[model samples]
Target: MDTLHIVCPACQTTNRVRNDQLGAHPDCGRCKQPLFQGRPVVLDEAAFERQRTRSELPLLVDFWAPWCGPCRMMAPAYEQAAALLEPHMRVAKLDTEQAQALAGRLNIRSIPTLALFVGGREVARQPGALTRADDIVRWARSQLATA
Candidate 1:
């Protein structure tokens, strides 16, 4: 069986999880928290800083706002993309409205934007909401290949 390396969201401890168990409730080896939670784990400044530096897998961050229609539409696609790319990439969502400071610091100019970060460096960004899951997944896969 194939396995994937994951950095625990709670403890930041690295865990090796079986690929087949990804869809199931895989627990962190250190903290015993569920690993494949559907929602994007919200990160604060320190957690974001730590994740950007320590995550071995690629990261796909969705910058969105709650009231934006397009952002709402894109939420499901983001979730689907996350499920598809698990064990290979880490998917996170940042509420630009809530995380305005970070958004401004990152120079985010749009409501629904997708950013791909690898090894703590942002490699690519796309503005506007994605209409399809394939588009999001394709972009992330390209980033993974090029990174």
Candidate 2:
């Protein structure tokens, strides 16, 4: 069976999971934590780098600041999108306020930016808030399809 490398959200361990068992709710081999919690993992700079570089799965990151209204408003939709997308890909959130240097390095000039990363490099980016879960899913999938 085909397998993919997944980074555990809880402990940052890399796990090899069978493709067929993706929807089976796989657990991390080393950490014993559920691989997919059907929600976006809250990321610090170190965790973001670990997940982006170590996992074979594509990553979708939301760059937001706490004071941004659109970012706050879109959080619910992003969470729903995570529920629909996990096990196939990873979804994460990074607070610009919390990771200032990382955010500046990434050149995040705006709040509520969605960036899709494959093979540890950003492939596509969308700048703005998407209020609907369906829209977020569609946009991310479409970006992956093109990438």
User: Model 1 residue 66 lDDT?
Assistant: 85
lDDT score at residue 44, model 2, on the 0-100 scale: 99
Residue-wise C-alpha lDDT for candidate 2, range 1-147, written one tens digit per residue: 898899999999999988999999999999798999999999999999999999999999999999999999999999999999987889999999999999999999998999999999999999999999999999999999999
**Candidate 2 wrong stretches, greater than 4 Å:** none
Tens-digit per-residue lDDT, 61-89, candidate 1: 88888899999999888888887787567
Best by lDDT: 2
Q: In terms of TM-score, which candidate is strongest?
A: 2
- List the candidates' TM-scores in order: 0.82, 0.98
Model 1 weakest 10-residue run by lDDT: 38-47
TM-score of 2: 0.98
Q: How many clashing pairs does model 2 include?
A: 0
**What's the alpha carbon RMSD for model 1?**
2.9
